[model samples]
Target: MSPCSSVPEAAESVSRFTERPALQSSKTLRAAGVWTGAQQTRLNVRHFEFTADEPHKVGGRDQGPTPMEYLAGAVNSCITVVIDQLAARQQLTLEDLQTYTLASQDTRGLAGTADVQPYAHAYRLQIAITTPERDEHTLRQFAARAEHICPAINLLRDANTGLKVVWSFTEQPTAEAAERLSNAAVGYTEEHDAPKPFLTVTNADLAASVSA
Candidate 1:
């Protein structure tokens, strides 16, 4: 539950956001990555950096995760979050959730054999979740609806990528499991603590000082 729930008008306003364009603001999101050779690349996010690489089997040095792995995880992560948020608004109690996403890409395009070697020739998402307050039918309906809310889903579908979603519910197990799920259920209940900045800059100092 969100802190806004305490104020009916505030909660309603939050819900009203759903009817508006998600990216209605003129603000833009950005990230930059640099290739480090041998299928290795370094990604830079605000004050953060991580390496990405492919396995030796695919002519890489196996320094880190492959791009496909990152894509699969990104899709799953985004949708799982969508499910959590959507269910919360519906007043459903989710106990446990896990998702597995699979996608296949054709290297033919990379090799110049085809114009498109879509990241996923075929895709499958298997979601196993537990929402104790809602029946299977209701949960399924919400799950499908949440899929449509996912930005990742929109990207994949728009690219004409083949995708499938399969989900099932199971009783949540263990106290730790319940606690973990509870944490996820609790949405942002507080205002932003970080000094919010809206800008694009070449360095951290300038970014922190300016609002664009």
Candidate 2:
């Protein structure tokens, strides 16, 4: 029997068929008692309290991931899981996998200023892998397979997708906290204050670094 048809027709049982298929539209592929819809393969995420050593200290890091950071983490973890599964099936021992995901979201979308709701304008990803005894050809094949099997990649690329904002809240900022943050150097946000006039203490002391 094909993958779409199986005994014990239930939601959990049907979930097994969520793997990347042969790229056939539901209309093109007809199977009796088969359900294929966005709801059938929806991606859900839950948040937990972030904990890290000395998270609240001025210089101490939070050691835990933020929500936006987890978005990128999901892509990397999905690709890694797919690669590991395929490698195990092929009797290939995995060494290490590295995936880099960069997503540029329009804040206007998040701020409800844009017509689009998802806020995801575009996402770019690069995967670098280091495996023992695996040649470049084999690595490329694995990479392609991983891309095909990753569910997050599929959902991100799906045309009929929407970003579901379940819940959001704002925290009141304290006066001390506000002042400290406001004193920081202006990099991305608009610079309303003018720079102080200063004489050339040292002419051409150091070359300036340009940043976007």
- Tens digit of per-residue lDDT, candidate 1, span 1-212: 23232322333323312454433332455678998898799998788888889888878888777887888888889988888898779877876777666566898866687898646877766566655543544654565567656788766765656765655555543333322322332332222321111211121211222432
Task: For candidate 2, give the lDDT.
Answer: 0.42
Model 2 residue runs over 4 Å out of place are 1-65, 133-137, 159-212
Q: Where's the lowest-lDDT run of ten residues in candidate 2?
A: 203-212
Write down the TM-score of every candidate. Answer: 0.66, 0.44
Which stretches of model 1 miss by more than 4 angstroms? 1-23, 134-137, 172-212
Any residue pairs clashing in model 2, and if so which? Answer: none
Native-structure RMSD, model 2: 18.4
lDDT tens digits by residue: candidate 2, 66-143? 445666677668866876798898766654444555566766764576777454665544343334533544544454
Best prediction by TM-score:
1
TM-score for candidate 1, please give it.
0.66
